[model samples]
Target chain A: MADEVILLDFPLSAFGMRVRIALAEKGVKYEYREEADFMKRIKSDLLLKMNPVHKKIPVLIHNGKPVCESLIIVQYIDEVWKDKSPWLPSDPYQRAQARFWTDFADKKIYGDSRSVWSTKGEEREAFLENFKVLEAELGDKPFFVSDTFGFADIALVTFYGWFYSIKTFGQFSIEAECPTIVAWAKRCMQRESIARTLPD
Target chain B: MADEVILLDFPLSAFGMRVRIALAEKGVKYEYREEADFMKRIKSDLLLKMNPVHKKIPVLIHNGKPVCESLIIVQYIDEVWKDKSPWLPSDPYQRAQARFWTDFADKKIYGDSRSVWSTKGEEREAFLENFKVLEAELGDKPFFVSDTFGFADIALVTFYGWFYSIKTFGQFSIEAECPTIVAWAKRCMQRESIARTLPD
Candidate 1:
């Protein structure tokens, strides 16, 4: 397509996968540039130039300008292509609740959950505390929302893929601690977009 | 102003200050309910019914429905009443950049900066690393954005206020390490809304 969006991302990156799923959901065609890892020092020159701070993948280049941050990119996509699947709820209160969950998933679940990859000690313990908070906050709710696949679902799904792929910290067993969240994650993955985009 | 919006918050909260400055910028009339710390702890009958999880302050109950999360509340305010001082920029790319900086200030600056409050060690070192990233990202730019005061400025001003107020990390002064950021903080403080909302 002449006007297809250009997504600069790696297939395995959960952050990049989120954008791919969003695009697929909206049925938007795009060019996908797989970026090499910086650990190997083989990433695209454009990516290096674009994201100097994080130098991370999942930089969505829509109409030539790059947008980083997976959640931010998702929101920008939703705003630009309004009313297709309606990622954000219409009611302001519901929308705020959605945003709170999205922020919670990003900052608390995905943000603090990364400590499993840390070297260990206080940092890992703090991350566990953070993860505990998410589990506590999630009581028995089927999803963060009353009934829907929305922004929060999108974010958590990304984290879920990470949890399974990493296979460390005994987190591969999401069933015992957070059954509801596990079920929710499964439900989100059942979608074709999610099923296709999830990393191996 | 019978139909005016209502803001439920406290000055001590950097989140609440975000809403306050946004309201003042828009010149919107509203009632400000100073939520008490005990009220937050005990979860007042009203707030408990309004915001269940993460029962923190900075809830803007506009036309009765509560919108929690300071940034979300600001966006809702901007969307609902857009005839006044625009919180978001016009161009899509510029707007995305503005949102990026706003989120960046929250995550990297405000969120990471809080580590400094803890006793010096790995956490403090991590905090300093985050600050260095901010310094590197923001070389000589007076504002996070190019020139104009936008979403990022509002977010940073809140952080500067809290960092200045907190005695826990009084030894680590921004004036000494981050002169540019300190100067920017001072420039932002000169704004009427910011100066007026000082915690007594």
Candidate 2:
């Protein structure tokens, strides 16, 4: 039986973009339905029914079962489409490390990115320092986990959109401070999966 | 050769308690190191080295490598210890569902628990409403996912400690509002893994 996959999405959401990149990387054919009125607080009934708990996109409806949460959706996409290179690492510890960083991106980086552009002085500096922490994690690796381009890369690279915003908004350079991070992001953007998400 | 396992923990922490329950469920014997001075902002050097990212516990150091984050650590414990019954669901969809709720607990419920105790009026009512959301998820099921006691249960039941605190502080009953949730907690509390976490 052919698999039916539907992604309830909003184009500008980094979380939705994570799923989009993962699906694109794995070469999964899915119906991408943009929640056109998402910003206006109008959710489709299908979305509400599919993801009653959160009532948010990007909900991945596979064969009628809904997977909410962007990281979980990326993972579901990785697990179901086993023909491609896995998005997450293979080893348990490495996998844990990958998840830890992704969770960090979700918890810490996501929150900081929202206000960094609007804030001033010490607040913005603290936010920039958080990026340096990520740069330190990236280190000499071409990717966050060793040289492999997978989960951690997908999770962090989606924020390139927000990075551009922060830089443009403040007339500052993230690349000026965290060269390695910018370089690593550029490396990830070279991939077809990532490039399509932020095609601007 | 024996498996060298150690858990960096704090007795009062819901996050640390999640790991302790999983380890206890798997019956994996290891050194349990309490972060006695954690509340004092004094961290052990081992913890500092093990989880340099967060500098937090409970870090499960197995064979000298660290796994941080409670949900990730619980998943790691399930993956590493082959002899035990699995903590997470095997099916990809169910696994995604389990991960979703656990993430919800970490992000939402964890925050709500902290202030619910000290809150009044509408804030306290809204906090109780969150448990009602959880109760709706549980429904008639013995556990969060199903009849099995595993990851989702471990993630939430640790908050039973805070449940008591909120009840005591607010001079109200959570069970009165969320009986199914309270019943499920009682069911989980009967297990040795959970019983030991909140022996008081």
Candidate 3:
């Protein structure tokens, strides 16, 4: 148990959920402080001092310093806990490829998928098209990184949590549009670390 | 001299330029092949094979595996040549900070900064406002990293090159609009590696 690690998080946030999975997988114990009143109380004064700009959740306060950004936090955890279960590949090229896909998920998939939640007509169609692109790329692969469940897999899985919340389950329909990716997401979630941290 | 590394790039591209600077900085030698005239040359089979989805440049082919995206490519180079010269910090917390800033440059700065290129108006003003956010975050720091140039520095400098072709430079005036960032860019460009690669 590392007393220095404190995660200021909420279970509902996909960003915070991702960090929780990383910590669980790494088997690193830390104080989990739920920020219940972010809108009202503004949560921890320590968190505010830690990240002044964004001042958002999913803040990982480690040994007194705070690190923001979900994916960035995962990368940090991977680097620090390298001796533990590896989140990223040891090979540089493989690691870069992993990052590329992770970034693709963040920029292309996350943004477009979120749009599907609030849109209709041509906008919804455009969102589905983006989904198709991801599906086409992910075709038949069990994980984004070939066989292993790495950082990219974790990122994709984190976003997939949004699937249940959006029309992705009924309207957008991942099985029809992106059957392969859907299966991939399902496979990733089966992992205990991931299964435990998914949002309600 | 190792001759196996291959880079699929176009000199005129800002993304490609980032890779060139990284390679130069690390003194990594590689064979370069530019993608010919994008539109008319779409029929080219080589590119389709190298990058099927995005079909973007700055792809590094190491040991026959193609790695796409500029930041990913830079990270690959850093990881491969980790011992030569460290472009990113080794400390996990510091690395996360670097990554957070780098993602900010990609999503916010380089992202919104592109509006300046699109035939002026409210969009261009939006772009200037985006640049101000970066300038404000940068403040008086000599470098984004404060003393040494790192991943975030490379990202911003590459974006600065893009600013040249955009109409925004004339409209906002770098020296006047954001002198600190302009000075920071100039200072980063002074480095031998950055100087050799930044566009004329």
The model with the greatest TM-score is 2
The residue pairs that clash in candidate 2, if any, are: none
Task: Candidate 2: list runs displaced more than 4 Å.
Answer: A36-39, B36-39
Per-candidate DockQ versus the true complex? Answer: 0.42, 0.84, 0.66
The DockQ leader among the candidates is 2
Alpha carbon lDDT of each predicted model: 0.73, 0.83, 0.77
TM-score of chain A of 1: 0.82
Model 3: share of true interface contacts reproduced: 0.97
- Model 2, span B1-62: residue lDDT tens: 99999999887888898998888888899998985365687788888888887888889999
lDDT of 3 by residue, B1-200 (tens): 45488888777777788888888888888898876455555424666688776777878888788888888888888888777868677777767877888877777776775576667688877777767867887888877754678888887788777655553445656557888888898898788888888876
TM-score of candidate 1 to 2 decimals: 0.75
lDDT of 1 by residue, A116-177 (tens): 66776676666556556567656777666656677877766787776664456544345555
> Model 1 - which docking category?
acceptable
- Fnat values, candidates in order: 0.56, 0.88, 0.97
Judged by DockQ relative to the true structure, which candidate is superior, 1 or 3? 3
* B103-133: candidate 1 lDDT, tens digit per residue: 8777777767667777767876676666566
